[model samples]
Target chain A: MDTRILLGAFIVYSLSTFFYLLNLTSERKNSYGRIAHFLLLSAFIIHIMSVVARYFIAGYTPITNSHEALSFFSLCIAGFFLYVKKIYKVEILGAVILPVVLVILIFATAMPSDIRPLPPVLNSYWLPIHTIFSFIGNAIFLVSFFISITYLIVEKGLKEKRFSFSIMRFPSLEVLDSINYRCMSYGFIFLTIGIITGSIWASNAWGAYWSWDPKETWSLITWIIYAVLIHNRMAIGWRGRKTAYMMILGFFSMLVMFFGVNFLLGGLHSYM
Target chain B: MSDIQLLAFGFNHTTAPVEVREKLYVSEEEIPSFLQELKDTCIRELVFLYTCNRMEVYICADDREKAMESLYRVFCNRFKIRPEYLSNYTYTLEDKEVFRHLFLVASGLDSMVIGEPQILGQVKDAYRIATTFNCTGFYLDKIFHKTFNVAKRIRTETKIGYNPVSISSMAVELSKKIFGDLKRKKILVIGAGEMCEIALRHFQKEGIADISVTNRTFANAKRLAEEIIGTPYPFEDIPLLLTEVDMVLSSTGASRPIIDKPLITTVMKKRKNKPLFLIDIAVPRDIEPDVNNIENVYLYDIDDLKDLSQKHLSDRMKEAEKAKKIIEEEVEKLSRAINQVDVAPLISHIVEKFEATRENELKKYIVKLKNVDDDTLKTIDILTRGIVNKLIHPYIAMIKENGNPAVLETMKKIFRFGEDDEEKLDNRKQGE
Candidate 1:
């Protein structure tokens, strides 16, 4: 039943993506964005219900496998996207971000979602705390990645004086840039907490406070990139196209940390 | 026959020069008495659509030639123009052409700038004024009401009036795209000339509150600032103002470029790289073209703005074709409606056919009767008359209510009204 409900969420997200695409392509201004927004809100609610049901079935937080982690990642993205939408009039941004979420959900559904015994290495309170914080941080950066690309497209159009219909309803360069900044600050805080909680969990599981695992090393690199972005933006006035480029770079680094280390490197965090 | 002729006469931008139109233009204050004078001349239902581009008078009158002559005399006497010269500049349309012309005008298809929206509002005001003066009757009222509907229909069905094409409005649109809300945004106006003042007013309408005016001459800046309730800055304060304002609009008569790359580069550093929008409408280009290459700076010279405007104008032109097609369809529908109004022949033909049938059938029944009495014959005649009138009443009501053309044609066919008779009805309806 939980898997069925999750499938229901995937379908709703697809419907929401269809409406956002329609809102983007059409020139006439109407309520397509508003309809897409409502659809996304309902999809998020159904997604939360599925996750809660999964917890009741498994008797633990569902972050121990690739299926659970990817599902949780997509859920965090949808949640953060909704929060960003409430703060900004970036309805067109959904056209780009919702497809990414849908793709992640597809990969998640492809993986095994059966109830399994919890591995001894993952049985701790830090399992949920570390994974939840890290997924939310990655989700925030994911939204910023699309926003950065939108900022670049609009900024280029303005510089070239080529006003096309695709980017016609996009938020301004300032608005996109400001959203990137907000994401950078909040994502950095969540990432710091995730890293700290992981190290403390490492002390309990592996009997060490610090270990140079591939995921840890890559996360450090991602953290450094965003730290530089925040510092330069506040102190040296790095903004507009420059800030958009940095956000794209930081998001790529985060991808390597979240997926590459687990899938290829076979680190201690390989359960995810 | 209704005997009411629809007439339209006007001086428009196409037919008359600006000087001639200005001379003949009637202000709103003068319209009531002008209408009364036409009323005294035996012209009843009329609406005077007065706008800067065109001044057309639509009238429903009993005498076409006399109405035209009276209108010319009113133009000559009211504006002190000679009759021959006025006749040379004005064009007149009648009946079907008048309906088509008013639809085109109301829908902005006939505007000087095709698909411009203000003409619709002006047309509405004209109809409202005529109604207030108690001038419009059923015919005029019906046409004007349909005119408004046509205008609204065209607006929704096409993208003709979607984008802003004028230079000042395009600037405001771009500003909104850059800054989501213009409220509390500061604008620095260079030169304080008429062009700058007009563009500034456009921005002000968008809620840009903090406006600073600067010019080469301090007094001119002060005067313009006072006029618009803005702060005046000196010419030497250009760099200082650059760091403070979000947008800069420059239009001056200087031969060389005024604001350049290095000045803005230093200003951007001082302002910590806040985004700056610069519009240079000057001939020699008040801002250097190279300044656009700078980071966090967006510069659009006059040529770029004009190019965007030209694109929008072409978009409107493409949509105008669609709008014209809609108007043609509406005109055809309205033509059918007017023809239905003049369906007196059809009504009479149906009654005569039924009467002949009733008389023939009654004669046959009477011949079969043995020793028929006068009272019995009267009762039979009354019964046949009652049946004929009752059968025809609903069909007559449907035709009078302007039934759909297909249904009306089916009724005509059921009555055996021939194709030749239909041609005669149309000919008489067209008054041709």
Candidate 2:
């Protein structure tokens, strides 16, 4: 039943993605954006239901396996994107973002989705708290990653004075930069808490608080890079193209920490 | 039907020099009187558009020869210009040519800068003024309204006015991209030259509240500062002032670079790396090129700005082709509508002529049949009317459905109504 609900969410997400792409390409004034926004809201509700159902069936947090982890991450991204859309006129960003979410959901569906028993080590309340915070932080940064790319394209075109209709549709440089800043600020707070809660969870699961595991070490590196970025942005006045470049760099490091640490180097957090 | 001839008379930037255009320009205050003078003559429907680049008058007249003569006389009397001299610089377009030219002007295709948006507003103002003076009737009103619609359609359907093409506007556009809002931003002007003043005025219009001016001569700086309501500083305080302002516009008559990389590096440190935008429009270069490499510093020199403007101009040129095609398509559609309107009166005249001929012949035959009863006479009248309508049904239908010019001419010839009838209709409308 949870799988059926997840499939319904995926279908709605696809429809929303189609509309967003249409909104981007269409020159005529239309309500495609409002329609897409409605669909995304509905998909978010159904997606939350699926996660709740999974939790009830599994008798623990649903982020234990690759399928559950990716699905939840994509859900967090959709949630954050909807939140950003409320504040900024960023309907155009959906044309790029919704497709990415759709692809991630596809990967999540392809993975083994069978409910499995929780391992002996991750059988605690810290599972949800630690994983949810970390996933939320990663989701916000993922959105900022795409925002950074858009910022670069727009900034380059304006700096070079080469204008195109396609580039003109993207949010302006200032709007994009502000969104990036807002994302990074919230993302940094969540990341810091996630790391602190992770260490506390480690103490509860294992004997020590600091294990220096491969995932732990990599998450530290990601945290330090973002720390430097935030510091530079607030203190050194790093903005526009420079901030965009830094955000992209931090996202790449985050990719290595999230994916590379799990598959390439087995770690304490590689139960999936 | 009214026999109002559509006429457009004007000279634009390409046809007349500035001196000639200025002499012919009618200010807004003078427009009502000028239009009143024309109304005193023979013109009943007219609109005058007077801009820096063009002087135009659109007319819907009953007598073209009389309207032209009156227009020439008014120009000669109002501006102290001779009639023969005015004719050399002016152009007169009638019918279809007038419609096409008006469409081009309203859509900004005939502008000095192709696809400019300001000319459309000016055209609207002209129409509004004409309406206030009660100078426009059915014909001019319909054409002007259609022109506005076509202009709007072209704006949405084409990218002709997408980017800023002028140098000052380009600088302003780049600053917006970097800084977002210029309302609270502070700017420092390096020189008091014409380029600096023009660009500064553009910036001032954007609401840059804190402006500082500096030049080699303190008096020149003070004079420029007083004119534009900015604070003037000595030239030696350039590095000191750079830290306080968000943007710097430098266009001096310097032989060497005035501001260099090292100076900006120190200034950025002092300002803690707040973003700085620099526009250097000097010929010999005001700021060094390497200053652009510093983080959070954007520098655009004269050549860079020119390249952008050149590219945008070319882009507009390409988009103008698309806009012109759209205009031509609309012109064709509207021309067809106008022709349909023209043939409405002709169609009614044909039907009326057939009915009149049928009644006259019926009367002549009825007088000869004195033995017929009243009921028989009524039946005969009905029979003759039905036979005439059925016989002429195909011809009337052909003329109404297919507004073909040759068909119209043939129908007129068959009825023995030729150019003389058209002249009579014109004369009758004049009487009305």
Candidate 3:
């Protein structure tokens, strides 16, 4: 039943993604955008229900497996997107980000979703806090990555003195850049806390605070990239195309940290 | 009533030069007397829109030729222009053409700048003033309301107003692209030239109040600064001000480059590589071309602004076609609404005629049944009225669906509802 609810949420997300894409090509009328926002909100609510149901059924945190973790990650991204859209009035961002959420949800569906008893090493009080903060942080980074991509496209269009449909749909580069900076800063702080909590959990479970685990190394690398971006933006006032490139790179490293570490590196964190 | 006609008469930028339009321009204070004079001349409903680029009067009048003659005399007397000169510039439209023309005007499609937004507001103001003076009757009120709706629809449904086309506006747009918000951004005007002042005014409209003015002559800078409510800085302070300001608008009378690469590079260092937007609108260029090569300086000369403005203008022109389509659709809708209104009186007339005949027949029968009680008579009256209403329902539906003038006329003639009765109905409807 929880899986069915998750599937329903996935369908709604795909619809929202399609509507947002349709809105970009539509005439200046905002009905398509309004519909997309409504669908996204519905999807987010259903996703929450599914997560809650999974938690109730499993009698522990639902993010004990790759399937649940990836689903939760997509849910956090959609939730953050709705929050930012409410504050920033950047509906156009959904046109770029909803597809990314849909892809993550699709990848989650591809993984095994069967409820499994927690592995002996996975049972812990710190699981919820560590995983929730990390997923939320990763979700925020995903938004920044999408916004940075939009910024680069719009900036390139302006520089080349060309106007395309996608460029016209983008928010101004200044708005995109400011939102990118905000997302990066918030993402960095949360990721820092997430890593610290994870290390604390590691020490309690494995008698070490620091581990050379592949996920840990990649997460650190991702955190450093965003740290540089934030520092450069605030202290040195670095912005525009260079910052956009950094955000894209940071998001890639985060992807490697989440997926590559699990599938290829096979470290102490491989169970996730 | 037969003579009443919708008429739109105007001399716009296409038909008249600035000199002619200036002569015919009526100030706001003069509107009451002008509307009174127009009313006295048999213009039953009227609105006059006076903008810098166009002077127009839309009217519903009883005698078209006499109304035009009186309007011509008013124009000749008020502006002191000769009748022949006025006639050469004046163009007139009638009936459906009047509606089409007014819709085009209200939607900014008839603007000199092509999709400029000011004309719609001017048109609305004219309608409001006419309404205040009791010069706008039912037809004018209905059409003006429809016109405003059409304008709003065009504005929302098309990209006509999406881009800025003027050079100064384009400069402001470029600054927004760089700075995001101009509210707290400082602007430095490098010269007291008209173009520089114009660009500053554009920035002022964006709520940027921190403006510093400097010129080759300190006195000129001070005067311009006082005029624009900005602080006047010394010409020698350009380097220091350059590091502080987010944008510099330069349009000096210099024959060669006044700001060069080395100078801005030093300023960039002082400002720690922050973005600087330099708009050099001078002929020989106040800022050197190579200054754009500096780390964070974006330089755009007059040609670049003009190019951007031209591109935007063409884009608006393309959007204008879409706007025209919207206007066309709205015009059709409005015409259908008008026809629906026209059918209302016809339906009422048919019902009234049938009831009158029914009353007459009932009166004739009352004498034959002299002993009939009041209650029975009331029931009989209700029954006859219901029958008449049921008999007219199909005809009313038919008339509403196919409001063909010839068929309506034939129906009215057959029922002895003459044109005079139609006029009375119209007057009664207007009174209500």
Candidate 4:
């Protein structure tokens, strides 16, 4: 039963990729898109079940160790995006979003084990708070990344005056710009909370609260870039392409924090 | 006989010179008369669209060739040109090609400069003209509605139409740069020429709706007012209008500079240091170029519209592409709908034909025979129509299910009308 549900989720994610690409290539995918949305939602449900099943086999929240943490991170991002999309109808985000979620889940499928016990360093209540907020921050930035990439793609099309036809489906520039701004704002707040919680956890566990770990440094850099953008947007009345460019750069800083700090440069937080 | 069609003919600055274009331009008074005059043009629908850059006669005809040729005659009569003179300047397209042209024009792709909003208003004017003339039919009106929709799509989907600063609009914006806002701005015009009219229209479009037109002659000022729909004051009121208006444009046909530096300086001090914008579009000199130095006044001739309008193409391309993609998609969808509308009736038509034939045969041979009238013949009538309906259900069903939308109607027509078979085939085909 467990493997069947997991397999169903994996299949659902894979199919979502195909439909997303199909929606791009063809214009009248009314049925195809509905099917894709349904499949992604089902995948999300099944993923939830699989996580519950895994936790039943072991114990605790499936977010402590490396394999479980990465799997949970991918699920959280997908779930959040799907939730926001339901409310906002920001349909253009689908082209960038679905494939990334599928890719992350597929990567999660390659991991070695189920959820395990947390280490002593992660035993504090502040640890889970730090990780949850960090995961939320990651999710928000990923959405920002989606919006920023759309901005670049849309900007290129507008340059060629490619705003006609269904060649590349998109929302208006104003809407995309606004969505990116909101994403950055939400992400910045969560990032601030996540960092503060991480600092508290570090102080309780290691006695040195603000040592410059790779993730901490990269996140600070990401925060600075976004802060600059927000300030420029608010103060100087910066708009359109300039604001879009800065958001894209901030996402790069986010990617460095998410994947680079963990895999390449092993940090103190990489025990699992 | 199949679906709706469209045809258009006109020349813009690209096709004709300024003299030819001005002669073709439709004044406000001219629109109603032109619409009334086009009643004789042998068209199912007619729209006389006249802007500064172009004048177009859009029409729908029962026959495409006949309509095109008749429109040619209408043009020659309207412009008073011989058949050979400038007849080659007009462009024509029909059906979907005509639809594509209309969409592109409405979306600002076919403007003298791309993304001009005036073309949209002109298109709407043409539509109004057509409706007023009672020349619009089902297809031409549908085409116009779709054209406007596509234009809106391009605007919202792309950045192509954003921040458009035409030469006239740049004059307005520059005026704003000198003055803070132009809500109650007083505007002075040296000449009552076409450029002045264009400038007035631009100012109105840019929200500087309050305007006072001053021309050299009282007669010309009145005539211009009647045409441009602006209040015209005498040339004596020029300095007074100057104090009231924040901007002034001079396109007069003067041989020498009219408003020199000293003349504008005196006017500016009277206005209490209020910023003024002056635009010189005359060849010789109407307002001296040295008036640009006048205190709290900014002046630009023709060259400045281009300088401020260097909006980065690279920044606009993404949105423009998105708009075009939307148009193409809509065109495709509309084309499909048009094709479906074309094909559906034919298949239904074939089905009806079969059923009618079965009824006719039954009524002739047995249904009308009262001598043999009983339950037997009544049963035969019901069975016959039933068999006919059953036989046709699959053939027409196949036509509806065909993948190539273009051929669906042709296939339906063939099944309905092309092949004739013996009457024996009906019942037998049904049983099979």
Interface RMSD of 2: 2.8
lDDT of 2 by residue, B56-96 (tens): 99998878899998888888999899888898899999877
Each prediction's Cα RMSD? 6.1, 4.4, 5.2, 12.9
Give the TM-score comparing model 1 with the true structure, all chains together.
0.89
What fraction of native interface contacts is shared by candidate 2? 0.35
DockQ of 2: 0.44
User: Tens digits of per-residue lDDT for model 3 on B77-190?
Assistant: 888889999889989987767888898998888887778888889898999889888898888898999899888888888888777778888788777766777899999998
Point out the worst 10-residue segment of candidate 4 chain A by lDDT: A159-168
Per-candidate TM-score against the hidden true structure? 0.89, 0.89, 0.86, 0.48
Each prediction's whole-model lDDT (CA): 0.87, 0.86, 0.84, 0.70
- Cα lDDT over the full model 3: 0.84
Question: What is candidate 1's lDDT per residue for B292-314, written digit by digit as tens?
Answer: 99998989999999999899899
The positional error of residue B156 in candidate 1, measured at the CA in angstroms, is 3.0
**DockQ for each model:** 0.58, 0.44, 0.33, 0.02
Candidate 1 Cα outliers beyond 4 Å, as residue runs:
B40-44, B341-432
Instruction: Report the TM-score for the A-chain of model 1.
Output: 0.97
Candidate 3 Cα errors over 4 Å, as ranges: A26-35, A163-168, B293-296, B332-432
- Identify the runs in model 2 with alpha carbons over 4 angstroms from their true place: A22-35, A56-59, A158-167, A235-242, B356-432
- Candidate 4 Cα errors over 4 Å, as ranges: A1-57, A79-98, A115-127, A141-271, B1-16, B24-26, B34-128, B136-432
